[model samples]
Target: MYQKKVKESNKNNIFKYIFEKRKSFVINDIAENLNITFPTVKKIINSFLKQNIIFERQKVGFGVGRKAMEYELNEEFCYSIGILASSTKLKFILTNAIGKILKQQIYELKSNNCKAEILNSTKDFLNTISPEVRKKLIGIGISVPGIVSEEGNFIEFSSKEKIVLSFIEELKNLFHIPVLIENESNLAAIAEAFLTRNSIYSTFTILTINEYVGISNFHQDSLNNTLFFKAGRLHHMVIESNGKLCECGTHGCWGTYVSDKVLLNDFQKYFPSIKTYNEIFDLKYHETNIGASLIDNYLEHLAIGIKNILFFSNPEKLIISGNISIYKEYIADKLIEKIYKNHIFYRGKETIVFSSLNENGSIIGAAMFPILDKII
Candidate 1:
């Protein structure tokens, strides 16, 4: 029985490795990369081919002898649904086994909507998924801007909505598949890390600056080692001893000065018609006095928070993610310059970079949860 379990585990690992590659891989390559025996890998590959989980691809010539056959995941074999719930919108993504997003949808939710209304809309959305995709779905992963209880029963959403346990239960009943809920920032970090599979850094932190500021730490080999630093409540972390009052009944929280809402509020005072961050950047490019000043202040506050995070954890890399990352080219250099100027200790450290996953990081990472859970 123990030997059978080990073989099954090995097969699952091989499948996960192929899915991550997202391309054809030779049997020897899989064995070499995963450190599994060639015979074991070949056995698994043959089994997957028979099960239609993977298919043989065109042979690739390698030096001499007959060409080697490559195997690639059958992407449509399984599917996952990822849902990201934020203060303003609920975003959905359907992905195949290898994490390729097949479809996406977004729904705006009123802040005042009751729990029942929210659930009803979510159910309706689920019902609309393509029957073909729904047929192969193995699970659903939800990324919320808040924490979920260990039992997966309760959610403490950032919007402070009364998202009851019954809501999760309803989703389970509706989908009839395993459901997992996790913090949005954590999911984003996972997605970013997965995409950067060759990155040398084993420990990194992801800071998502959107309507809210969220932070999540990650350790590549051992996710359990990643610390939970009360990411959503970062807004309550006092940056100023006697600063302006925050919604969390705090004074001068870092989030108060470094969020999308704050940036928009400050920019509108200068040009009342400017509605988006892109517009703010447009004014900054033209060097408007208010735009320059607003950007400078935003960068300074961002620097302070980043400096603190660096000193506190000093991870190998710090990834800046979210809608704000779209403007990274404009802000990254200035933010780094400010950080070095204020905290010279990190002047030469390769600690910060914008997230490559962009806004899709959380959704992709959430989708990967069901797949990762089975293999990892």
Candidate 2:
């Protein structure tokens, strides 16, 4: 039993270590970094090659002797479906074994029957996948803006639905496959970090500033770690003692301050015709006195929430994601300045940047979850 456990542990570690490491790593290099014997690592590599789980790339010359073979995860080995649902948006993506996106469709959530839209979109996604790909289809991953149960399956409450658990359960019965669900923010952070993690930062806190708010932390090997899907609840954390009232019937919740809805609502008071964030990002708006003041106030409030995130978790890098990422270029300097503008004695110096993945993080993460689950 002990020997079997150790062997299994080594196999899992090798898989995760390679997935996190830079692409095209040689066998000897992996053995050295993982502190395993060369023969043992080579044997494991042979097993992976036989299973077609990983494949060898071009050999690299070692300057003196036999050329070493480079290897990488075989992306074509399997596929997963990722679904991201929010109050105002819906997205579906097909990804390979390692989370490389293959096909995608996005839609605006304007209809009254939210669950029906999700159901139809899911059915469409499954129907469109080729029969060859269906053979490799392992499971489906779901990300949503709501409080998910600790088991990572039940969605207790969402803005539009009272109990989404039944709908999710029905999906399992209809499809007859394993399904995993998680809070959108948590999955977004995972998706972003999975693609972008590097040696400079092992930890990242992702803040999704959409019509609603969501936050989660990710590490290079975040998939191996267990996470409680409570990030959805963090949106309701009160930042002010008695500030603006939130729709949840609370005062000073962070959502009431930095959320896209609050910002758009405040913008509407000055420009009633503005329906979406696209109109608000125009530089000409920043030229006006009222517009400048509104942005400044919004930036300050956003800073407050970021500072709160820093104080509690202190991740090496804080990423700004979700709908706000669409306009990061316009507000990057101002957002950073406001975050560092005040509280010299209190705020910690943290590297903050906008995710290059933009708004696709949740869907990618959602798809990546089930694929990674297979490896573990």
Top TM-score model: 1
| Alpha-carbon runs more than 4 Å astray in model 1 | 1-8, 62-66, 111-114, 151-153, 162-166, 197-200, 222-232, 283-286, 342-349
Backbone steric clashes in candidate 1, count:
0
lDDT accuracy of residue 19 in candidate 2: 73
Steric collisions counted per model: 0, 0
lDDT of 2: 0.75
Question: TM-score of the candidate numbered 2?
Answer: 0.82
Error of 2 at 291 (Å): 3.3
User: Which segments of model 2 are wrong by more than 4 Å?
Assistant: 1-8, 57-66, 107-115, 151-154, 157-160, 164-167, 198-203, 217-232, 239-245, 268-275, 313-316, 342-347
Residue 155 accuracy (lDDT) in model 1: 76
Against the true structure, whose lDDT is highest? 2
Which stretch of 10 consecutive residues in model 2 shows the poorest summed lDDT? 1-10
Cα lDDT tens digits for candidate 1, 166-234: 666677776588787777777777676566642446667888877678888765443332322234446
